[model samples]
Each structure stands twice: as C-alpha cells, then as structure tokens.
Target chain A: MSMERAIGFVVGIVAAAVLALIARKIVARRGGATGEYDERQQVVRGRAFTLAYAVIMVYLAVWMVLRNVELPFFNHPSSVLVGILLSVTVFVGYSVFNDAYFRTSDRPGTYIALIGAVGLLNLILGIRHWVRETTLEGRLLDNANLMVAAMMIAVMACVVIKLALDRRSEAN
Target chain B: MKNLKLKSARAGRDMSQQQLADAVGVSRQTINAIEKGDYNPTIRLCLAICKALGKTLDELFWPEEP
Candidate 1:
C-alpha cells in the first residue's frame, strides 16, 4: 500500500477506537449496562449484513465482467477500491436505516456528527485536489480518495434522510 | 396483521411500547415491529416480554385457534 493508504488505514483504526470510547461514555451517561447491540439489534444487523454481502457479490461480479471487457476503470488495478466503497456504503446505510448500528440510547445527533465529520474531511481534501487539477497542473482528477469521499457523502445523505423520515413517522 | 393480543395486554397493563421495550431491554422500534407482526422475537425475548408484562408465553405469543 502507498504511504497515503497506510496513513489512512491507521487513521481509520484510531477513529474507530475513538468512536468506541465515545460510545462507552454515552452508555455510561445513559446508565445502560447493556451498552447497545441487544438481541433484536443483532438480528437486524445479521439480516442487513446478508443483504450487504449479496450487494458486494454482485458488485464484484460486475467488476469481473468489466475487467474482461477491458473497461477503463477496471483496466486499472485500483478500481477495486470503488467496489469496496460501494459495498461499505450499502452496509452502513442499510444498518443505519434498519436501526441496527447505533444504540437507541445514543443520540442520533452523535452519529450524524460523526458522518458529517468524515464527509467534511473528505470533501475538503477532494476540493483541494480538484483545484490543483484544474488550475496549477497537478495530478489527475480520477482520484480514489475523491471517489470514496463522494460515495461517503451520498451514503451519509441517504442515512440522514432516512433517519429524519423515521423520526417523523414515529411522531405521527 | 398485528398480534393485537400483545398490544391489548400491554395497554391493559398501562404500559407504553417504549416502557415495555425498556423493561425488556430492546428498542421501541423492535417492540413496535413485534407487535405489528413485522418481526418475530427470539424465545428469550419472548420470555423477557412475558415476564415484564406478567404473562405466559402462550398468553403473549401463542397463536389462537380460529
């Protein structure tokens, strides 16, 4: 992996650890000893994961076909990142909508903030790359990081919309 | 298509869905799904709900003969 990817991976792990710490604090503040992921949540998550697995399988199959046909994106080796990001978006979005990921005791705002933080970080980076590519003759625009950011933003929007709709429905 | 009996039992006890869900250690959405017949709880959860509402498994979960 490139140094950028290596750093990104380490950052991802650190972010996950930080998220766990935050969740622990939330659980403690709520006085819920169980700390989320109850039996029902697990069942929902299982079903969501099954669906996400099917999605990834289909995506990989399409990638294989495109590779055979010598498509531009698949012709390059790094296109696999696209497949992985798609699968991740589907998995996260599915779990978020199904209420399988975040604990009910945890505030929805917390997750929204988390997604917003990541999305904002990516957006800033992607925009900087875009500006460089457009003006000062930098590297190409077909960046995996930017593509991943776009996909994350799309998925985050969907999850947020779904959360709002569910809240409205519950109110009704 | 809900198991109205469970709903009635819960209401009869003056318990809201959220109250029952909290008592049984689940989200309100899960309890709503169970009552609406959109989702089935595991045997363990069924027992938990039964105990929370002071009902037997059959009283809360068994299918009634038409």
Candidate 2:
C-alpha cells in the first residue's frame, strides 16, 4: 500500500504486458499469408501444454500447502517475484521434457528451458530480499505471490489450451 | 518405434531434411522434427510429403500398431 510497493507492482505488470504484446506481434509477423499456430505446431503445443498443466497443478497444490503451513518466515515482495519466475521455469521445463520424450525436434523447448532457468535464479534472489525489498514510509511491499502464481498459470493454460483447440479443429 | 517407411522413403528419394522441407514448403527444422518422429505433420503437410515422395498416406503412414 506504500508508494514504493505500488510503483514496483505497477512496473512489473507493465513489463509483463509489454513483453506479451511484443511476442504477439512477432508471432503475427511470422504468419505471412496464413495464420501462425499451424495445425502441426498446435498439436505439438497441445501435447506440451497438457504435460505442463499437470505439472503446474501438482506444484500449485504444494504451494498452497506451504502457504497454509506458514514457515514463520517473513513474506517478502521478492518471494512473489521468485514464485513467478519459478512458475515460468517449471512450465518450460515440462514443455522441453515433453518435447524430448515425444521426439519433437523444435528447439523452442531448449530456448524456453534456458530462459526459465536464468529467470528462476534471478527470481530467487529477488524474493529472498537478497536483492533488497522495497520499503518506504514503513509500508510493506505487496508480495502478491499467490496472485503472481495465478497469473502465470492462467497465461500458460490459456496459451496451451488455445493452441490445442486450434489444432484439433484444424485436424477435423 | 521407428517410422521406417518415412525414413526409408525420404532416403530413397535422395532428399535431405532441408531438401524435403523446400519441396514441401515448410522449414527444414520442421522436416527434421518429422523425420525424427518428434512431430507429426498436419494432413495438408502429410499430403505434401506424400506427393513429393510419390507415395500415398497408407504407404507412408499406417504402420503396425504398437
């Protein structure tokens, strides 16, 4: 509720939105005459998503349990960011695992894995206050870890399900 | 677990992944993925591959069930 925390949250949201918009534009540009998410890609993505969703559901259960237990540890803004980064890393990790198991050769799996790992490490440092938590006027930063986790889950689920459905329809 | 038909047909035709992809109007990466059995091609793309290699769907696909 403090000025600094509000600024940080706002900045995070803005950064996420900007990245999403840029990614959408890139996919759009690649479509040429036909739309991107072609039939094959959709199928591959769907399979990957199903696996990612299953893994995330498991992780979410664990997160909820941990939250309930409340480790007597301080809740920091950095923790929320770490949660977000971990969510991404786990998703991509599962995606790559799915690709390798299914014998899908798309290198996007590798790229996502690498990016997720780096983001995860950064997130951990940020969340632990190792990177320093913002404090101004004695007001605490809103470490919306649950909210961040939910956002990441929603974004990933939407992407995977949409592509899967698209592929199914195209196949039919 | 190998898709021997697809692999042999691709080889018999003297076409590499890049060559097959160029003929089929897809990326070489796509072809590589397909050959590795890491991906299944769409119907349209499967048809394209079939046509390019002078084979039918039954000939290229439809292996014994595992």
Candidate 3:
C-alpha cells in the first residue's frame, strides 16, 4: 500500500519475469522435464543453500554486534528483510556460477545484465526514499532495501567471477 | 577418469557434444560433465545416452577391470 512497497512489488514482478523467461526456455528445451537436476547439480545446490543459510546467520550476528557496540549507524530492526535478501543472493550466485540454475548455456550475459540494471534502479530509489524519510526506523528500512539492491548486484558479480575462474581453469 | 567409451562412441558416430546433448534432451554442459566424469547421470539419462549413441549401458558406463 505504501509507495516504497508498491515500487518494490513492481520490481519483484519484473525480477520474476526475468526468472520466468529463463524457466520457460528451460522447460521448452527439456520437453517438459521437471526434475532436471543430476547428482552433481543436486550436490552443488545443497551446498549453496547451506552457504546461504550461513550467510544470513553471520550477517545477523554482525548486525547485533554493531548495535550492541553502540555504533552510530548500527540502528534499525533489519533482521527480516536484509537477511532474506542476502540469503537469496547466496543461492542465486551459487546456482548461476555452477551452470545449474538457468538450464540454458553458460552465456549468462543477458540475464545478469537485466538483473543488474533493475537492481541499480532499485538502489537509487531506495536512496531517494531514505533522503525523504523523517524517522530513524524508516530511514534504516530504506537502507535495508538499498542493501537488497546491493545483494542482487553482489550475486551477479559472484556469478561472473565464478564463470571467469571456471573458464581459466579449463584453459589451464 | 573420463567416460572414454562414451567419447569414443560419440566420435565414431561423428557427433558433436552439442548434437549428443540435443539428442539426449539436455544442455551441452551436461554432456560435457558426463564426459569429464564430474557428473553421474541418472539411469534414465544413461539409457537415453546409450540409445542415442547406439551403445549399451555397460559399454558406455561400466568401468573396465584393470
């Protein structure tokens, strides 16, 4: 209902559109196959999820420490939102890097670009919202949303790095 | 160890990795993984690969006794 959430909902829909594009292509390519993961992919996904979970826990722990130490910027109840964002990044980054999520080729340039562009837009919007907010909690929440954008960009960066490393290893 | 038999049969049939992967209804990377020994395909996929290459499961997948 709020402006920020309404815009966030729109962004979520767009992100989902990108995901659906990849999923539709995959299903079409597989001729309606549902469980396409092989053992190797399954293991990679399992490990990825585990790492994502760890990231969320560690992130929350750090935030708690910052708040306890009375750091000036360590404010706001961001546990739920930022935790969710960073956790998703871990999974997406891992899956994309491993050549498992897209079900398409390793040519992930388009999808990554789309996500990155949208994420930057969201980050700008979050900063604008933060500038307008009067309350500390509201400002903090806006910053958390900005972190969601950063998380998306981070995931994309990790995927690119993984792809580069894999390619180099192959050359060697 | 590589799936040398699968590679050999694919080569004998003059099929590219993409061709075999298409015939088996998977990404080319899946075929590459199978060949690289980094992935073990399911029994269903195994049968599909065997059928695609006109080879039996044992010939393509079974380890040779040293």
Interface CA root-mean-square deviation for model 3: 2.8
By DockQ, who's the top model here? 1
Q: Which regions of candidate 1 are displaced past 4 Å?
A: A1-34, A134-142
Pairs in clash, predicted candidate 3: none
Error of 2 at A152 (Å): 15
Ranking of all predicted structures according to TM-score, beginning with the best and ending with the worst: 1, 3, 2
Q: lDDT of each prediction vs. the true structure? A: 0.79, 0.58, 0.78
iRMS, candidate 1, in Å: value is 1.2
Task: List the DockQ of the predictions in order.
Answer: 0.65, 0.16, 0.36
Instruction: Report the backbone clash tally of model 2.
Output: 4
* Each prediction's TM-score versus the true structure: 0.83, 0.55, 0.71
Docking verdict class for candidate 2: incorrect
Best of the candidates, lDDT: 1
Which scores higher on lDDT, 1 or 2? 1
- Give a tens-digit lDDT track for model 1, residues A1-172: 9999999989988997997788667655654434568777888788878887888899889989989998766877557777778778887788777777777676666556666776787777877777768542233335655776777787778777887898799899
Question: In candidate 1, residue A138 scores what lDDT?
Answer: 36
> Per-residue lDDT tens digits of candidate 1, residues B6-61?
99999999999999988988888899889999888899999999999999998989
Error of 3 at A168 (Å): 6.0
lDDT of 3 by residue, A1-172 (tens): 9999899989989988997788557545644434366555667788889999999899889888888887655565565577778789878888777767654433366556666776887788888878999987777654765877888788778877877886897799
